[model samples]
Target: MPELPEAETMARDLNQRVAGFTISQVLLAFEKIVASDLKNFEKTLVGHQITKVARLGKWIKFELDSGGALLAHLKMTGQFIMGDWPGHLSGQWPAHTRAAFLLTDGNSQQTLFYRDIRKFGRLRAFPQDELLSFLSQLGLGPDPLELKPEEFHQLVSIKKARLKQVLLDQSLVAGLGNIYVDESLFAAGLSPYRLATTLTADEASLLLSHIKRVLNESIAHRGSTVENYRGLEGPGSFQDQHLVYGKHGQNCPKCGQALAKARVGGRGTTYCPICQK
Candidate 1:
């Protein structure tokens, strides 16, 4: 699944490329991908102009001039590609393309394709009032980058689950998934199995700092591309900088001991046992 950095990269890239463009038409290859009412989805977006693009946790928000919003969640293998329209009658859609938005900027036209191999991703177009209500109902926690050290400490300390499980919970700290949680824990020299309430003030502070640093660095590198994650331009290069996410049985970069893997909260977790005490 695309985490914070990956989703952030997509939002930033999309904002840069398609913010002011108008949606000339919308074609849904797979109607099931639409989370909103099928009839209202196409009616709300066909003539609207995109005003801004933003990311809320793992969801991308497209603010429209019509006062509504088109929101998307790239669940696992979803990606957006900007390219020439292959013509509706050509039947030349790219592999796994679930939706396409034909965009125009007065002179030229481009199609923004949403591809999802697993079909778990979803898109929704909501009215202004309903959009606000729907977003509020998600109950996502604060973004780690925006949280103060003291605030982070309090949030983590209140959770009774294991540290790794707490970190993975979107309601506790938004935008962290399995990949970044493992990397953040490894970077902070903390064990995944440690209880969340057992974290000292110092450990919590260090963990919060590392989480922000790691996420910013990953965004700078365009996010880790372990599987089918790609920005509007291309795949990210951060996988080369991974410290311990998928390096099970590999020697730790800090210590020479082999990295170990275990199931923490039913998620595969990798850490250096010698270094991450």
Candidate 2:
């Protein structure tokens, strides 16, 4: 699962590698992958020069010179990689590539492929006005990296759900998934089961600090690649730095007690019961 760090990595890599490239052709191996109208999807993308690439919460945004954009969400197992154009036959596509964009930088050309093993991802094309409208309607909370301490504390003070569940709510605070939430809570010495409304202002600030730290560190390492997550460059190495995520029943790094495993908001969570308590 590619969260903020992974999305950040992809956006950064794309800005560096593919920015300014013009979309010359659009090919769709699986039309359902597009969440927008089929009539305008390819027509709006092709012939547009990519002005920039960015991430809004967990989604990737591809900005064009014409003020239009292509937005992609790599839902579960989706990712982007460089590839060659496939043959006319559908079977000739590279493994898991549902869509491809042939790009040209005047002198050179390349192919950008969207791959998803589970086919759960979605892509959409929008004009300038429509893109702004869509983003406004998405209703995501502040990006954790840009969130102020007071803002985090205030948000936590209003929420009534468990700490982990509130953190997982994109509407409350965007970009936190199971891995970073557990890691942040453990690092802050807070239990995932703790109610968000019960946290003191100082504790909420402390948790915010830990959340930013974990996310920044993961972004630096290019995000965790515990599963199928891969940036434009390659798989991330941050999984090597994980403390509690996916490490159930293992010895806690902070305490000798065995790490406990449970479900918070139906997401598999891992933490040190002794330390977190």
Candidate 1: regions farther than 4 A off: 89-92
TM-score, structure 1 vs. true: 0.96
Give the per-residue lDDT of model 1 (tens digit) for 1-277.
Answer: 9999999999999999899999998998899999888889988898889999998888898999989999999998988998887666576778899999999989878888999999999999998988888878888899998999999999999999899999998888899998899999999999999999999999999999999999999999999999779899899888898889999999998988999999999999999888886
Candidate lDDT scores, in order, read: 0.91, 0.91
Per-candidate alpha-carbon RMSD to the true structure? 1.3, 1.4
lDDT of 1 at 156: 93
Q: Can you write out model 2's per-residue Cα lDDT over 83-176, one digit (the tens) per residue? A: 5665734557888889999999999888999999999999999988888888888988999999888899998778889998999999988888
Error of 1 at 65 (Å): 1.4
- Candidate 2 achieves a global lDDT of 0.91
